[model samples]
Target: MNGLTNVSRRSTQLLRRSLHTSAALRDAAPAGQTLRRTGLYDLHKENGATMVGFAGFDMPLKYEGSTPVESHHHVRKEAGLFDVGHMVQSMFRGPTAAQFLEHLTPSSLATGLKPYQSTLSVLLNPTGGIIDDTVITKHTESSFYVVTNAGRRDVDLPWFEQKLKEWNTTELAKKEGGVEMEVMEDWGLVALQGPKAAAHLQSLTSHDLTTIPFGRSAFISVSSSSSSSAADTHLLHVARGGYTGEDGFEISLPPSTTTLLTQLLLSSSPTVQLAGLAARDSLRLEAGMCLYGNDLDETTSPVEAGLSWVIGKERRSEGAGFVGESEILRQLKEGVERRRVGVVSEGAPARQGAKLVDLKTEEEIGTITSGIPSPTLGKNVAMGYINARTHEGLHRKGSEVGVVVRGKMRKGVVTPMPFVKPNYFRG
Candidate 1:
């Protein structure tokens, strides 16, 4: 069998084994409780999508006919559409909006980011623990757009409200107009990802996609020949960035226009398949992106997660006064006890909760948080944390290690991440 076929078969076996062995890996839908749905819920269902509960919403896990491996390969070779509207979209507006956001994140939003530019940032707690990861886009000096993970809604929303109220009452806000936070309810966010994503999306809009560049966004008008209301084209906020480590765009538009726009994109080319969560997971893993609840949490600090690059140089040099600055700066100077790293192993796939041990001594060092058989690489790839002090000399790439899989120690190695090269479009 070919690699895709072999991986697909192995994936089936792994799923069956996971369901029986791990409760955390089972369906998230609560018994007798209704799960929320996104704007594209019905569309997904009509297209033979298998829905499952994720982050309190019923989302597409995969389609009925194609395997996840096939979907993953399709995205790498061509293009795919994904429904990511479950993420929280919010607007921060006011004269001091940029300053207010800078206080919440370590990124230098006030000085480093120009209008239309975006940065990946983390919201830190008072103790330097990560509250949530977010993407903040600068629309103007007084206006900003931010998208945060849906799983962190309960923790993130209330925190934002409390902080906004406190900041508005401060003396700084009294001099400059106070900041206002507005959640964009029911907005539809879709990600068109793959190597050909730019060409596919460019065919539908008049705005030059090349001008947006990676980490930048623009408001553009989309026209489709399939639409009856061609004259009344819809305005879309298109950001040229995604989690798949591919050249793509995350298009946010009004909820009413979502279905029509999706259909138009699908019709644009046969390669534009609708991918689901299953493919999304593997693609992001290969891209070395961290999933919120899996690789990050309130107890995990950005410095330890190997995400210190997200901290702006200006912020580190001149102190931005962001939340958790003291603890984060201290960690930067002194270093952390444990750090996240990538692991590649042979034999059965190492699922979450698998323990990592010293290759020769068999001493437990850490636990795996995320793992999968990479469809592209056809190898068991995982990410976990290890004691930085204990594995100090052995932390470099190619160091031999062992992962406890099914109660047996399996051979593994410390490897550099982004197992597959990222294809982000810089221009």
Candidate 2:
């Protein structure tokens, strides 16, 4: 449960050290040929999307209209559907699936999870480093659903395969009835996010969305007259979770039914708009969420990234059988040297790698990982790292610290996280 990349906080240091060359450099070298597209690619283009290469896919970074406009369109009055098909989707089926997953992550999945509930988890390398962050949803005792980052697919798949082979040969894994992994490579996934998302989605289903809390999912059918092929044929799986810091759902459907569902969802609620990566970034930032490449990597740990809460108390004591138990436990008790924190600046917004300097001595205390002018808060908000004990010495509510905004230093203050309050539906 402790392995999400602190993209907004931790990745800043890694990215600054690694990708300082070009802003347009795509991470995963070309897939050898043309980039891949989601099921809604043509539909997005028809809507005047400004596509950019991301990971190994050509994705919509923004629309011809602009990003702020698209963001406001979602926050103020309606909803926005984002295509996230680039993510890796898979299903694990076996009598011992739960046990197998428990072996990989530190979560007390056997006790903490209920059927149809999803929890965040980290895949750990043997050396106590994070392989990837993932979401695992328990469908039943014998079946589980997992989603991982698209950029890590090549590395992730081989790791899973090799582990599966080892487990299949072992005695414990044999008792687990032999695991079967299915990679749904071409599946279509869309995130319908915003305050009005539920209202708009309600018109498409008879199911009571109010009963479905955040971090939970259900398989149901959505009917529409404008649907291309069938009326109510597609069996849809919807998870009530999102990165936008709003109450919303991520829907998985058939690729052919993608256009129809998107069109109907957009038209069904005149309030819902098509939001792209631009709005997605700002919204998640305001929410204090991490982007994998930018926020987290193998070099960082949960305690350092400000996510120790994901580690369960029982697991801390009983041991969840994950890879990084010893070092993570040590850090949990002893603490790390640096901790991720949120900062509020007075002058220009601090960009990545902007050194945080002490106003008195002007010595570098830390560096900004992610910073921007928050659309909701109307302040320059940033997430960064500072020396755990010395941080109090450098900046505070009354004291002034310098953030290297451009070439010159600007004034800033230490701030708390979630610039915007998260609207997670616990009910």
Candidate 3:
């Protein structure tokens, strides 16, 4: 749901008309600049969109209706289509690409990933701080498809280049040779997320969509009849992975075919509505997923963020030898200083930056990272961190805690995440 950046009070009114800025401009600005538009920006304008500043792009916050109305539209019948082109998409093609990537993240990419399969990974600093959370998709042994947050575009791209240079200069990869890297900047990506997403996408391709299991992707050609671009289009990658807790796919299409593909998918696909940031935020919160800026930042580590699972069991012992391995591997054996957990508040939503206080000591233990009244769960849910032992002290199994919500303390309980069941497709 990351959209256009630097929206001014004046330009908010211009969203219903047309926009001229491109996505790249949006990424480069932080102030109330004219703002850049995505390929679907005009389509959103035509659909009566109320655009808002998000991430770095001017993206539609909602279209033709209120947020609650759009939220209900998605949860009930079919699906929702999200234009996530503002996200940074890149390709890593080199003989030592896997090894180079392994040097940046802690995940055991060489073992856990298969061709076209993807896994969530964390880029770590030398001290184990999370540089950024990313999705690493394996296209082959020597090539990788990566998608990261737009908010981190400034930090992420330079980090990758610096690391690539250092990796290429390393004795191991240099001695072997045949290793290189490239970043695909002109790609357009869309996410079709919800229960009926698979069915909707299936109508366009003859490939066995079912054969592409969850966490896996495939390359397929999409036939188009629009005048925007070519007749038949090729989707470079389609993965059964998503931000919302639903059976969905993230489609990476060529830049020129973006508008045509979107038009085709929206017009032909039933049970799918164009969704924006508001609903996407609610959906990700309900699914117990973390947002990079709010839930994770450069100050937080994977262990403290409850992402230890991304580290392979063997790597925790033998070590995959990535950046911050010294600290991350140490925490893998011993526990972390703080642990992220889910909290169920009784009254109002305990939003991010809200303090978590111990009922007895009245001490501020941690801060809320993400929270919302889950439309699906019909209650207030929040995720945050607390002193690792404090989490145990407050809620050993069925104990309760207190959270500061709306300037007042409210009763809450420690609970497992995904307050609603995740509907990710395993097959």
- The most accurate candidate by TM-score is 1
lDDT of 1 by residue, 218-332 (tens): 9998886647596658789999999999999999968788888888888888879999888888888888888887788788999989999888887875366899999888898
Model 2 alpha-carbon drift over 4 Å, by segment? 1-25, 31-33, 69-73, 226-231, 389-400
RMSD (Å) of each candidate, 1 decimal: 2.3, 6.5, 6.3
Per-residue lDDT tens digits of candidate 3, residues 68-126? Answer: 33443474347888889888888888778888888899887777788888999999999
Residue range 273-315, candidate 2, lDDT tens digits? 7877766766777788766666666767777777776676787
TM-score of 3: 0.89
* Candidate 3 colliding pairs: 3-57, 4-56, 4-57, 4-58, 5-56, 5-57, 21-37
Residue 301 of model 1, lDDT score: 96
Better lDDT candidate (2, 3):
3
Which sequence of candidate numbers ranks them by lDDT, best first?
1, 3, 2
lDDT to native, each model: 0.86, 0.75, 0.76
Error of 3 at 65 (Å): 2.8
Ordered from best to worst TM-score, the candidate numbers read: 1, 3, 2
In model 2, what lDDT does residue 350 have? 75
Residue 411, model 3, lDDT: 84
- Report the number of the highest-lDDT candidate: 1
127 in model 3: Cα distance from truth in Å? 0.7
Count clashing residue pairs per candidate. 0, 8, 7
